[model samples]
Target: MTQPPAAGPTPPPGAGWSGADEIHDGLPAAPAEPGAGGRGLRRGLLVAGATAGVLVLGGTGYAVATYVSGGGNQPEEVLPADTLAVVKLDLDPAAGQKMAVSSLLDRFPSLTSGEDDDDLRSTLVTPLLADNEWGLTYEQDVEPWLGNRMAVAAVPDPGSEAGVAGVVVLAVTDEAAMTERLEAVPADSFAFAVRDDFVLLGEDQALVDRLAAGGSTLAEDAGYTEDVDALDGDQVAVAWADLAGLQDVVPLAEAGAGLGDQALSGRVVLGVHAEDDALEVTGLTRGTAPTTSTAATEPTGLAADLPADTVAALSVSGLGEALTTSWATLQESGIPPEFEEQIEALGLDLPADLGAVLGTDLAVAVTGDLAAPQFGARVRTDDPQRATEVIDRVAGDAELPVAVSPLDDGYVLASDPALADALAADGGLGDTEAFRAAVADPDDAGAIGFVDLGELIDEVVAQGGDDAAQAQEYAALGALGFSASTTDDGGRFVLRVTTR
Candidate 1:
């Protein structure tokens, strides 16, 4: 880390620095800018915040460490059940930094600019190094003591940044030393309180106090726990969010073109883990909105017809059902009146002929060399003859010249009729070595897709002007694949990308 600038003369020992200057009734005013050291420290904090945000995009704390050690309270107990979102980790900051940097290097070599860990550490990490005793205590004692059970949470708050308060909780050791260190540091920005086994820190002192007092606990939140339980815990980090509640606090949710239009009233949980040479970030989003019942997808076995060389494919069961439910949601959201008007303009009865329009089963794929791309769409229907008639009618009404031809179990639709014919002629991706290597146990999945990175990069270079595709990182990536499965209660989706 970067060495902080000089902090000037040291305060006289035992001054308690806890004088009136340090105490605030509520929301302490921003402190005067310190010298160069303080400025560097602030910059470092900003960078660290940015880094933390990046880490969250992919995916802990000491009730957390004890939990990891299998001898203490569960990490979830650190936050009350009312938490809007929480991210828990079992790894220390230093170790996490190492793992993140390593994975990033493997995933994108160009990011390092030819610098090794030591060189990068000196240049990038050095600036954030603090020289105070508080910094020393946190790095050497507090962090190590907390072990793996450190966590951060977003909770409901009327007075806070973005109208939602955030708290960082961690188990403590050497309480006296920790208190002394904390008191010695400048307290203009954050307020912290110590509990029996842990410490709570946040921008709002009252919020931190409430959490420390176990008020409006998130541990008791049924929705939050359900989502958290769904997440894979063996990873480096896991995060849970109450999407509906967050919509009220986060500006992005209230703005147009956001989750509001999608009617995403549910929770999202994600687990982030680092593999041998790749990083995996998987999330599960469950909608709580009352949805119109739609028919379940019936197996069509269309996956068997995709070409062996197919790189990317999207398979859907009961496409008509999914579309119907989605269309209902759009109508209820009251944001897109044009869609209903357009449907009327097309003179199409979606519910009456959705089976023919979208097919019972749908599969789309991008195949062949990236330099020369091929696209194909295949769908299953109960009646192929009737489906053909509806397709022709829609084409004539919309002035779209679409051609649907018979495939194994249904019909194939494509811009070029020859492409549709080509899809029906080949042995499918299920039999290909690339598909087997890229996805795990594809035979049982409800939906699946794959993308060949090498081909994608080549196409990018060919199509993009300038240096868009001139990165070595593209060479490191092999393929990306995603799969989904429906259960009795809900569904699960996973997307995985591997290294070459």
Candidate 2:
């Protein structure tokens, strides 16, 4: 449903791709011969080496291949047109992990469950390095080529080392030493050529040359540029994908209806930023939706009405409108007949009842311990009497898991009658400190979610009869929350975790 963008506007000054800025001389460009073990083998080694470097560096690794230097900041300029996906990661994994562990210690000073930096390195990094030969020079060779930014492009290929289309990595780094190291590598083992400061690593020398030539770059893609730049530039990292190109590759027969038309064909961008003592991961994506679906404003005091002990809560608005809109489109597209037929086969009338059963705004919350979970829902409908009839009818026929009860201007659906009654109580979640601390900007959130990880872990521990290890792992989590809102181009979802 998302129409691809036309040609992108001119890139702002200094906003060009990194690592490919300057032209340089190195090994003569050669045509990559098919079935030669050299290209494929070297590519495989490069990938493994890069992955090892990231882990060894403790998450400071760039997403794709690189020992960067000698280029502008726009690494994406090197990506070919057939690129199926591009990913970028810029987090200092070590710092992030340290922050998370320290926060966990602050929350549960007595809980001795999580691993320290050294322990993590020994347990995770060392073993992975030991298993791969490329790990030998990961520190000296691979790590030096990377800077704070890196981008990887996945392209289709039949002769790649992985027996699929090969990938390319771009990063900004000083390449003198990197180039020397590559020259020393056995020519029969690997193939690579340095172009100025940019190091292109892939299975095919010809493809790599084409990449260095800078024809039809991903940077030239207007839609991708718009989506990636839309994210906060200060993010620890950023990433984007070419869903439309991918849709073209996979066979139509293999792609089910869910993965077929209306399922995909657009771009997605993701970013991560650390702020307010919370690490936020944000994403913007437009695959099937034609336009941003606006959310109705949730009632101000909805959370305040919940039980004080409620450990988790979520509030979503505009569902009724979304469903109705989707249903209409489905009808126009000839999908409703099949859907209706399926519903009828199951002795149900979905088209006649779905809209009447659900409300425009919905709030669901969880209370009690993990051993005895309690759930509650509040649905705001235009006609409560009709909603009650529909709900009661479903309950009578055991079509639903729980009965729905009428409440003030809405309906309460819960796991138990007592839980429903508790929801109807006068108090709400907004008055609670935990809820306030978890949500970042509740007033503007189209959809909001909160989790008291400490409390949830307590429930997990209570229910852990013999799985002490699993219980301990849960203890490392403190509290987390998320907020969703509509953006001009697409939707933005942000997740935050206040580590314990």
Candidate 3:
């Protein structure tokens, strides 16, 4: 396990109790008093928020070391169905996931350097217990009961105008020990209840009590279930948000103007999964605005036809039409006046002429030696002559460092005339082993991107410095690829980093 910096030494048994008692004794006499609601609730919420943050950090590290597969007790199973947001960490995962994380740690031993043992008590519980105002100690209070999974959730608070409350759910091995610790904490606002094998901590006693009773749960919500099920692999960590539910706490106007009506009506789910040679993050959004018919579709292998030596490349199709269709929306969304002036200065109409310049399919690539790399762009067009005229108009008076050449059905623009000629010829970037390994389904993606990490690292190494030394450590790390596509409900995105 990764051993982070020590938080500090643990206090002797009961040594910090005097200070905690003093602090608690200083509180307002009545729970309903004005000062109690203000100061006491704020203090309790701070502790709860800090505890949740620390546990998330600790849980993520623990999951990386001890994850396994199979259904287990999840926080959603107990949280209210109206939860606005939740972050969960699972320490136990499946056998395959364990091996994947273990292999990754092996490849990068620095990730766990300075660790004494793999025990969660040493890495997680110890830091939290040390020198806390609550007078808790790891060996005496927490270590005897800590369990493997934890989650922090934000739920609506019906009684408050803020409309939200924070809850920390911790799975415990011994309910008795967990209850003893909660009873000993010296804070008026602190409230806790043990439900089954988990402890629920919050600032609001009424809210905590209600949750302990457990009517409907987040796991039972149809939208939550569907989004969680949509994740691609066994997740080590997950985060979810109910956008519509959160509007009661924070207004949509605060997010920014021009958001569609249905934008906040949806939910967002993000998950992290470990793979044999990489760690993958997948994201899915549901009930957002639908993709317009003019939106880009699958690539037509434009980037794949770039030179095999390409260091980086990107390709997308139908962007011109999309730009044209969304122009009015963009204007309303606050496109700067200077930007429009710049477009007009290029001797082009606002959207139509600019759309003609972009054409139907567009691709950009970087190739040649790193020191003097070549840059090129290709735009597919049915009217090659008109596109050439637009390109010339945009590059007027040699203002831009580019030369344009006509292809059979498109135009190629490059920093060097030779590169423009080369981009017009047959190429084989798709056939390269690195390209194939990085991108999974380039042809089917609406947008595709690739980066030659190895080549970039080589350049850094050549530049020799502390950065070069650090770059050498990632020698085994190879290319990175990204792909995105519109789904029926929303969109799907995947990012992968390949390692040798």
Candidate 4:
């Protein structure tokens, strides 16, 4: 077969970064003051502080990853005040207690026996603890204290040798005498258990389960434990606790030299351990508080339960009755600005019907499914490429890395220098496959941004580049978007632009 053009582009791929750049240019520029990207930089330093507030919008349904990247304090409400219930990944009595995860498991009667008593974390438990929401003072505060002449905590050293991540050793001392020793260690760094009443709310459990399973010593033998109530209409809260235990409960410290007593409470758990390993249970103990629950808000005859605030934000008026209300309710309930803006931008009239009243909107969670929203929702863009990219971003933000996906409708032309720089300069980035490879292999410069050979070729030909003939051979790259960036790995593009 006559191969494609001698100076032609590579085999043509499906689509490229065609429309996104266009959309970016056409849409009103976001306020330059600050936003998700700005806030993201802040999140890196302090665990829970926010210097400023920023909002980033993507094509996802809503409430995906536009969160505080800094440790500064800002009053941005992530959830609605009237929310039925807020579920937090928890561990202790069950993998899902709503308190300090480490403490909860320690007090959990049934699963205590299976516990190594030396290790107290689950996969889900660690990440949440690392976040500012939980209020950990520093990394040392979360680390297990080993035995030393004195440790970071104020407890009676449980043993002589303590371990974490399977490394390091410390000396355990008598609680009564170690005051002098404990004084040397920074009280806050070693005082990991300082916050006993810590609590958090999130939407993932399987992830917690995975993390919990990774620990060497099982938190508890919670296989047979029965749920007091069905999870169907309940809000789970993670209970926190220490990975190890104290001498008060066991002979772990016989010649023990003290098992490092850096203890934990029930408010910082990472996952839920519901199954009761009958072998390790003790009698039931009273709990600190009652559990939380929620039920789907059935329609009250209005077309929709739209949030007033979100409605005000969108400024959609002259709308049908039921839909207006439903949308209003949703907006008030932490409806993402990106989603609201897009919906309003669609200019789609709200349908006045029973279905419309009872919001049939689709909601996606990183690790859980939102059974229903009081309003109807759909993943706006059905483009697999766009959808996958969005999902990957969400997962990554949450610290979970999903496989790469295709270029999406949003990966369009852009006049913005920041976005262009993030996309990088490989000609093959405009399409889905190249994007998948890029996101999948971020280390490789070629695989990171705006991939798709055909798209690049199209851009090159449009520009009538000196190497125009060679671009035809790269038909697989697609059309090129004029703007490009070397920002990712710190390289500058010799050329970047869209076709005429």
lDDT of each: 0.56, 0.56, 0.69, 0.23
Clashes of 3: 6
Q: Write the per-residue lDDT of candidate 3 for residues 109-150, one digit (tens) a residue.
A: 544554443655346555544456665566556666777778
Give the top-scoring candidate (TM-score): 3
Mind giving the per-residue lDDT tens digits that candidate 4 earns over 335-414? Answer: 67796575465443333332222222221111011121111111212344434444444445556522332333212211
Name model 3 segments beyond 4 Å from true. Answer: 1-63, 66-71, 116-146, 174-190, 247-251, 257-263, 287-295, 333-337, 462-465
Q: Which whole-number lDDT from 0 to 100 does residue 43 have in model 2?
A: 35
| Model 4 segments more than 4 A misplaced | 1-173, 185-271, 274-326, 329-347, 351-500
- For 1-500, candidate 1 gives per-residue lDDT tens digits of 11112234533434323442343222212335744532233234223322332233222111112121234544567677767788876543334444543554445544434323222212222233334323432233233334345677887898755788878876664455445455545666567776556677777767776666655456667776676577553455678777677777775446764445455467777776555444455666666532222324344355656876666787767777677667667556674679768767766676656656677777887666534556778777776766667777777877875567875567777666767776767566777655655564466566776766545555445655432344223555555666666544355556555655
Clash number for each model: 30, 24, 6, 169
The superposed Cα distance between candidate 4 and the true structure at residue 221, in angstroms, equals 27
Clash pairs, candidate 3, are 67-93, 68-92, 68-93, 68-94, 69-93, 69-94
Better of 1 and 4 by lDDT: 1
Q: Pairing residues by index, what is the TM-score of model 2?
A: 0.64
C-alpha RMSD between model 4 and the true structure: 27.9
Better of 3 and 4 by TM-score: 3
Candidate order, lDDT descending: 3, 1, 2, 4
